[model samples]
Target: MEEPGKIKLTIPCRLDHVHLAGHAIKGVLAETIKDSELVFLIELAVCEAVSNSMQHAHGCNADCNVEVSIFLCNSELVIEVTDTGAPFNADLLKNKQCHDPEDATCEKAAEGGRGIFLICRAMDEVKYKSFADRNILTMRKTIKPTDRDGEP
Candidate 1:
């Protein structure tokens, strides 16, 4: 069993596995929070991150494991996706902005590279690292109280 504020689930790095992960996460968020929009955003961010690993990191050649850890603290949701695969080019994402959707560059037209862009835009914060043969991507989104006067 998980603690009150944390949930951890692991799924195989297969195309179908993404659906299970998404469903589990969405359920948890729904049960824990009253706001549905926030829940959907978190779910989408996680799905994209895991999908990227299944498609690009594993190259669809070998079975892989994706470990998802979600924790809620002070109304903030933190999600991490970790996988064992070839190291990713973290520099490419950090150095370049998401292609202007209208840009006609070859890289922008490619399917594989756009996953990171979607992940970045979907979450409030996105970070990546390659450590000890694992690629870890962490995304964070905060849920502000409806009465709060400040912007999230």
Candidate 2:
């Protein structure tokens, strides 16, 4: 069984193992997140971050590891996705920002250039850090305390 407030998972940097992170994360969220809509949004945000790292950091290579750490606090959930790969520049997205700001153009967004935007849209907070040896993307979502059946 996973811990109550914290969950940790590491998987290969490949599209195939992405679901492993998702499945384990859902188990944790199921215990805390009482709203189905919010659960789905959180899952999507997590997946986007993982997919981005897998694609950008490792170039879909399955040899490296992508670590996902999830922390559930009183009324919020914070998740971090970390990868060991080439340093990334978060400013790239800022430079590619669309006039609308919230999302890039359909052409770019549809081409998988909007992972950051989609993550930002789905979660309450999104942050990125590229350290000397690792890249970490953190996302947080506010959880509404409802019944155990995931009803608001």
Candidate 3:
């Protein structure tokens, strides 16, 4: 099937606004993914990633904004969350969250650090990059094939 589309969104950096990304992603991907569980996973992962950017990225400053972009690439769903805040060390997140609390450092604290772990767990693939201008978190998941019209 030919790659058909993408959706991009920007929201104010506030906890209250995190739900917008979840709703937007589910709306956009609904045509391609019919699994309620997978939909929940996408929404959860997107919300967590965006929440991390808003809460930790800009010090939870509500004035800032978080950007989310979802695209169909290589027969997979690719989601990217970008922010203007200081970049954290991605190498620090190479491993999943440990069961023991002591194993997590300040960077991977159990609180919101759980978001990073969930994002990595839900999506088939996850990536992050701390660029000079912005930090980007990329997550990908392959969806079940749908009709050519993009209807599941």
Estimate the lDDT of model 2: 0.79
Order the candidate numbers by lDDT, best to worst.
3, 2, 1
Per lDDT, the best of the predicted structures is 3
In model 1, the runs with Cα more than 4 Å from the true position are: 1-4, 102-112, 147-152
lDDT of each: 0.76, 0.79, 0.82
lDDT of 2 by residue, 1-152 (tens): 76686778889988988888878788888876667777777788888889888988889888899999999887777899999986567775453343334555666444446677667778887778887788988888777656345465
> Candidate 2: minimum summed lDDT over ten consecutive residues — where?
93-102
Residue-wise C-alpha lDDT for candidate 1, range 1-152, written one tens digit per residue? 77787788878877877988889888877656666766676788888888888877887544678889898777687888888887677775674366536757776575546667767766788889998888999888876776122423
Model 3 regions lying over 4 Å from their true place: 1-4, 97-112, 146-152
Q: For every model shown, what is its TM-score relative to the native structure?
A: 0.79, 0.80, 0.81
Q: Candidate 3's residue-wise lDDT over 1-152, tens digit each?
A: 52357677989998988999999998886766667788899899999999989977887898888999899754678999999997877875588754346665887654635677778778988899987889999998887565223455
Candidate 1, number of clashes: 0
For lDDT, candidate 1 versus 2, the one ahead is 2
